[model samples]
Target chain A: MPRPQPEPVQVVKQRRDAALKAMVEGVPYVQWLGISFDRRGDELTAILSYDEKLIGNPLLPAIHGGVTAAFLEVTAIVELGWSMIWDEVEAKKLEPEDLTAGALRLPKTIDFTVDYLRSGLPRDAYARARVNRLGRRYASVHVEAWQDNRSRLFAQATGHFLMPQRDG
Target chain B: MEDRKATLARQFIEAIPHARALGMDLTELGEGLAEIVMPYADHLVGDPSTGVIHGGAVSTLMDTCCGAAVMSHPSIPAATATIDLRIDYMRAATPGQSLRARAECYHRTRSVAFVRAVAHDDDAERPVATATGAFTIETNGGAT
Candidate 1:
């Protein structure tokens, strides 16, 4: 009749660390986008370096709107994939190599919404995603992207992703 | 003049940095409609097990197609920018098949254009994803 206790901090940290490692090393598309994670603090930040190939407008020299959207989406996916903890049995059995080689499935997106607040300049950008809700089969994340000044945001996105089955 | 419009559309699409990166090709252009294609590449795969294309790639395709539609509108603007966009993924796109996006700018005001688009692989009825977006219409030396 009592609620189950939450996972211990150490165990949770270990799983989270493993997930992040897999996200960076295992995913080739993430590498193509030049996305990296900054996990020095409590929050994980997605970083997009300025690339000439990401420009959408030659006139304004602006980053492509779609590229910005893609960057935000990838950020949300990374946030969700890196924080998900597997079941106890699977967690115990997972090795670093297993985690790297598709031990867990990537979350599939159901819907994605992006708002362009300002034109993205041709510069490095940073984004962060926070999970609003995490159900057993679904998760919703809100993400924001900024360049130079955080207050002067470039774009924001909200996404719903279908989570992988935990026990299967 | 029609040929000029087609040339302009192609130039505009090719000028986009992300479109070039994704190897997007402007396949068709009309008064308010545009179609673009993105070939499948291993680097674009999201689910390695299934070899399915990433959702972001689909989003990029739709977004680029939508912008192209806006640019090809009869009352073309000097410049346009995306205001907002929403995409719903219906299903995963079949791997190794190029994705095609068809977009239409259904309505336009003095400063805004509304567009809707769908991305599909082989089956036209079964779309991989769909999108709706608003774009800003900016004129040179004119009101926004």
Candidate 2:
């Protein structure tokens, strides 16, 4: 049998975009929080747009800590899910079109620890997650959230997730 | 004094936009302890397949409860912000069931307060999640 041809760069790009979209759309809380993701290849940056409903302290005019935690958790889970999907697609084990809302299973959170560096200002916030470890049964992700400057993070978190079982 | 703290805690939750949006109700409050309830809503669902509430929603509940606990503490009846929080998910919250988070500010220093909390649904015996947190203590009415 002839060897399979490598996918073109453009084809790879489209597939990546589809995968990221499906994964993000799978959760309703993301929509509830009005969170969006900007994708560049395998990298994702989660954005929590500013809204009056997001304010936790009206006096300080600060974003809610719970909202910050939700944003960071969504970033980590989506980033981890995207990495898994990308790997699966490359290995020809999955297809992007097959992914849909609630179709792809995301890893479950075992524990999450968040450190608040500063009070989040009343504005848009951005977050990105780095996968520290990925195993067959578990994964660890660290996420950082910033408002204006990338270096000046207002919050950061580390989370451990239980991976979903794959069918043979 | 207890009545004052309770009133402050209720006012605290009311001033929060997100907490109000989520329909959090201050059920019980005392010195260093707070209990808040969040009604189940369609938008809070995380898994559409199972209709389970999102873990992030639970996290928010716990965080807010912990903050209230810190603020109501006798040693620190001023505004506070979460410094750090760690949460563990014990199980998924049942859909259509309201969740309640109870928090206690078990310890405090000049500048820091320690809190622990648990979230539960209708089945109070089994907690849906538990959290431990630290908060910045502003004893002089800094940010209230």
Candidate 3:
């Protein structure tokens, strides 16, 4: 298929904007998984709500590990914006709205690995992330999620996301 | 279902390194559903700042849970990969509490399966987080 007339950059910008907004409103997966979102500047934080549905037993209910990965992905996407993905002269910066319209998109994950620690219970789960270092070819970031002042960790991950080139 | 549960328990024991590292016990397992828990230890708590548990640590446990559940099925025969996963925070685990997770495979077709899981810290009555995810079950026959 011939490339669409709209600048390739526009494609990304539109998608980027949509992604940003969805990041704010949360996705169906979030609702299904019971994950929530909170944002500040370029930073994003995931908030897990405490409830009966989340518990597995007394003192040791299973913490949904997928939610851990999802939170990290969200933080990474938001952090990507501040990183080198935006540095390309030809790359068009996208707003939260652009992604909502559906310009940018994510690919099927090839593989992911995670290391888990203290499992936090229902009541307090929080994780923060930063882009850290990034390049035109790719970006890398680190994230940490914690629960309570006690800081029982539930999950962590290291992975990659696709970034197709866009026209300036 | 009984056969499936036995298969899940065997797989859980085989898939997760921590199940042994943390001395995990198989609480329960069934068709499209399973629950596992591990003895709590101070070392699992990796966060120095908050003196609580680290998020990545919890995620790892759940990842294995998902992988084990999907891989245990006889029909599907490939390693599973996650598209992405997100978790919300509610409260910290009790200092001496163990971690438990209930995982369920909702929809399954050739190569992809939709899953949901919930984690609790010592109190199954109240969950710390609920998780839903997509797993690409890399089948040998391109079943999907």
Candidate 4:
């Protein structure tokens, strides 16, 4: 059964690394998604890790397209939710206890699209994506990868994420 | 055979640019249909719990087979890109020799083509997954 909803949770507007780690640990399956990030200003440069299990074609030693797509999708979700996490922390400034519950909230993924430009080989790989447009109703993000001086786009995925809605 | 696609179907390995590296070959082809196979490896297996092969590999192979089958038409100029691809896993791929995939163009309009495919190791009746995809043919040649 789906969990019951609490009242609409507004953006707290704060930031912390502990919150990020906590969220990452929240979803055990997320480890399989292969995503890591470093923030530079507002943009994020993420290394999309690849494991042997992700391989489809042993002959080419190329990572599978579905894994690439799934990786891109998770990257977008975490990066977008970062802002909401920060917001929640900021709200806690009024009362430290409020921030404690902030880490529990997660972003709602509405929709996303991935465009595959080049294959991500078995060699070292990563992705760089930035939020293109973030509005109340929707958001869009663009991401790609580079290795051995060759710039092959793994994907250009834009998605719609909704904030937590209010409940009685 | 009397099938148009069968006559036109490219030999799985000998026909493509890099089929040898991927261990893929033509399984069968007929009017509005064709199949390709990629030999399995230890790397394809995922967590023992799900025992499922990664979804990404399936999409890539299926996409390649579908596009290749569609481009076989001489006028098509052998160029295609995926507009959208969706895969649904019905069963897990057991560690085996190879994975076989078959695709067909269900409906072809002027600019867009609709294709579907299934992947299985041996038992064709028991498919690992089903895939439906949209392809946009680049008539200007595959270079771009």
Candidate 5:
């Protein structure tokens, strides 16, 4: 069988962008959880629309811990994909077939830790991630989710993801 | 008394929206242990390239299992909430297998309970993920 050829640089970039857009707009799990994204300059925010399906404690009527954890993790991945982009010049030097050949690539979670500071009420929630560091093979992110006010945190998480390598 | 406790515990698990959405089933409940299962569904896939189940689904299973353990503990309280949880993913779960989670509440205090859990598909020895969590109890007159 003939070996598969690497896609052109422009094609790779387009593929990466489409993947990210699908993640934010129509991914199955993300859409089920009602997650949306807004990117402004360098800041990316994940929004979780309120629904009865998110409530864990019916009495307190609070959101589920697992749901909140997933929200934070997704926010981290989304931010990493959009914020850690390589310039066109750098992409030109990398391996044509490398996984991170273009500006962004998918990330796999190595570890996820979440702290539940307060009960998440049955209301819309927002989350944002800060990339602590983005290395060639790994990245670390800190994410926080809040409802009503940013000062009032519903949950916070720190995640480490394994990234695909690319040449300098 | 055990039957009543088990029934209450199942009720608590069924009340949660995410658990209900995932169709979690409570197979067993004891003083401080719980076993739950999540059936495979195509919509649960996280990666489009690979049809394997999402890590979040496993996390939800473990969390719900741990919560059931806390609810069924001997020193049951009126209400409980997760304080913190740390999950380590050993590997991606197989695409078409039903994942099961078993959790145990190791200890309990006046205001907190400690729980540990593992999620596995077919092989009991190899876990897809494991987690440890702390839950805060409502305590005292608050015991429901």
Candidate 6:
């Protein structure tokens, strides 16, 4: 048997970028929130751009608690879905264009728990999700969001999702 | 005390920029209880194909309701901020329908308040989602 050839660096980067873009575009809420992703290989950092409409407490001028939760939830869902589709995209079994709006089914949230550590200031917030457990039918993801320093998290969440069934 | 809390609840929602953007209205408020409604909007849709509102939007509604509940609680009449919130999405909210969240502060200590809330559209029998949360009760001064 011949050894399998490794994909070129440029090819790998293009595929990853395409996959991430398609997945993000599929969610309308992500667009409404003006959320963007900074991808470095399989790692993803979700960014929520600062907006006046995101403020919950005018006195403190703090970001809404719900907005923070939404950011963490979106991060977890996207990161989880990307992990599942990475191999298919890399193997050329799935096309990036095919993952466009509603083409790829993202997991449904069963439950989510969020903890607020500090008040979210009026600024851009960043988050990253770690897949704690991924199974065929269920997945658990933990996400942490920070505004200024990554070590100091403003909010964090753990979400359990019901994975979409794969087409036979 | 009851009247004061109700006034506080209304002011609390008014001060929130996102709540105003979502068109959330406070329908009811009492001691340790609050009810808020958010009208359906295209911008809040999670799946364009289904037109279903995003779970994140529902979570926002519930979180705000819980905060209001905490603020109205007799034990913690001062301001409050969310410490932790757990939400269970029972089903997708019906498209083209507004969502209402009712929350109650079931328990409270000197510095913390516990809240439980449910969100629904036209069908209040089956909630679209439910939430339980803990909030910090500010003792020094209200968040005003």
Note the residue pairs that clash in candidate 1.
Answer: A55-B17, A56-A64
Model 6 has an lDDT value of 0.89
Between the candidate structures 1 and 2, which one is better when assessed by TM-score? Answer: 2
Question: Model 5 over residues A1-168: C-alpha lDDT tens digits?
Answer: 999898776776555554456546534677788888775544678999999988888888889999999889889888876655435323543333433322334677888989999988889999999999998888999999999999988899998988856444
DockQ, per-model, please?
A: 0.70, 0.85, 0.06, 0.13, 0.47, 0.80
lDDT of 3 by residue, B1-144 (tens): 778767757655654433554456666755566677755665554322234544444564565566556655545446666554544344555656777877777778877777777779867687765566677777666654
lDDT of each: 0.85, 0.89, 0.54, 0.58, 0.80, 0.89
Model 6 lDDT tens row, B84-138: 9999999999999999999999998878888999998999799899999999988
For every model shown, what is its TM-score relative to the native structure? 0.90, 0.93, 0.45, 0.52, 0.85, 0.93
The clash numbers for all candidates, in the given order, read: 2, 0, 79, 12, 2, 0
Reference-based lDDT, residue B139, model 1: 83
Model 1 off-target regions past 4 Å?
A1-17, A86-93, B1-6
lDDT of 2 by residue, A1-68 (tens): 99999889888777777777787877788898999999876778999999999999999899999999
- Superposed Cα deviation of residue A89, candidate 1 (Å): 12
| Model 4 TM-score (2 dp) | 0.52
Clashing pairs in 5: B78-B143, B78-B144
Q: Report clash pairs, candidate 2.
A: none
Question: iRMS of every model, one decimal?
Answer: 1.1, 0.7, 14.6, 8.2, 3.2, 0.9
CA displacement after TM-score superposition, residue A34 of candidate 4 (Å): 3.2
Q: How accurate is candidate 2 locally (lDDT)?
A: 0.89
lDDT of 3 by residue, A17-88 (tens): 444554334333334334555645334566766655443323345444444555565555545643433343
Fnat scores for every prediction: 0.75, 0.87, 0.06, 0.09, 0.63, 0.86
- Please state the CAPRI-style docking class of candidate 5: acceptable
Candidate 5 chain A, which ten residues in sequence have the lowest lDDT sum?
A94-103
C-alpha RMSD over true interface residues, model 3: 14.6
Report the Cα lDDT for residue A22, model 4: 54
